[model samples]
Target: MNFSAPSGEVVADRLSDFGIWEAEYRQTLQQFVQEVIQQAETDLEQEPAPSRPTDVDLQALLDDLRAEIAATRFALQQYRQSLSD
Candidate 1:
């Protein structure tokens, strides 16, 4: 065991831990993205289809709203996780 620098075994352990964290973080992000897409589709379906509203870009608005909700939910989840961590 080298006191001045960490041994290869310690470095390897740290790398493994980082890999696990990265995998978990990626999974969470992927789930959030899918949820956002699904929510946008739901919102579009629930929106009222007006006959005279030709200028209303529903898809664009829905996309924006979906992104906003996803970001908010992601941050909230991260905050909650941080508290536990």
Candidate 2:
């Protein structure tokens, strides 16, 4: 007699693949965050002493960072939904 495999095995395989992808995605995201932080710190440290007022460029940098963080949050939410499904 021949035997057949279980349906759940397919799902388990998919989940395993997803888990690996998720780990890599998380690592990449973390590296991006660290780089952003390092860039901000370096920019601040390179500034001249209190002789000048705050620059508009700093505000632009902050806006860009906020947009990136918002995008990351959206991606995380989608990933959570995929895990549940």
- Number of the top lDDT candidate: 1
- TM-scores, each model vs. reference: 0.56, 0.51
Worst 10 residues of 2 by lDDT: 47-56
Task: For residue 21, give model 1's deviation from the true position in Å.
Answer: 0.2
Query: For residues 1-85, could you state the per-residue lDDT of candidate 1 as single tens digits?
Result: 6468888999999999999999999999999999999999999999998779669899999999999999999999999999999
Tell me the RMSD of model 2 versus the true structure: 22.7
Which pairs clash in model 2? none
Instruction: Please give the range of 10 consecutive residues that has the lowest summed lDDT in model 1.
Output: 1-10
List model 2 lDDT by residue over 1-85, tens digit each: 8888768989899999999999999999999999999999999999976876555698788999999999999999999999999
Instruction: Give the Å error, residue 38, model 1.
Output: 0.6
Clash pairs (backbone) in predicted model 1: none
- The CA lDDT at 56 in model 2 is 64
What lDDT does candidate 1 reach at residue 21? Answer: 100
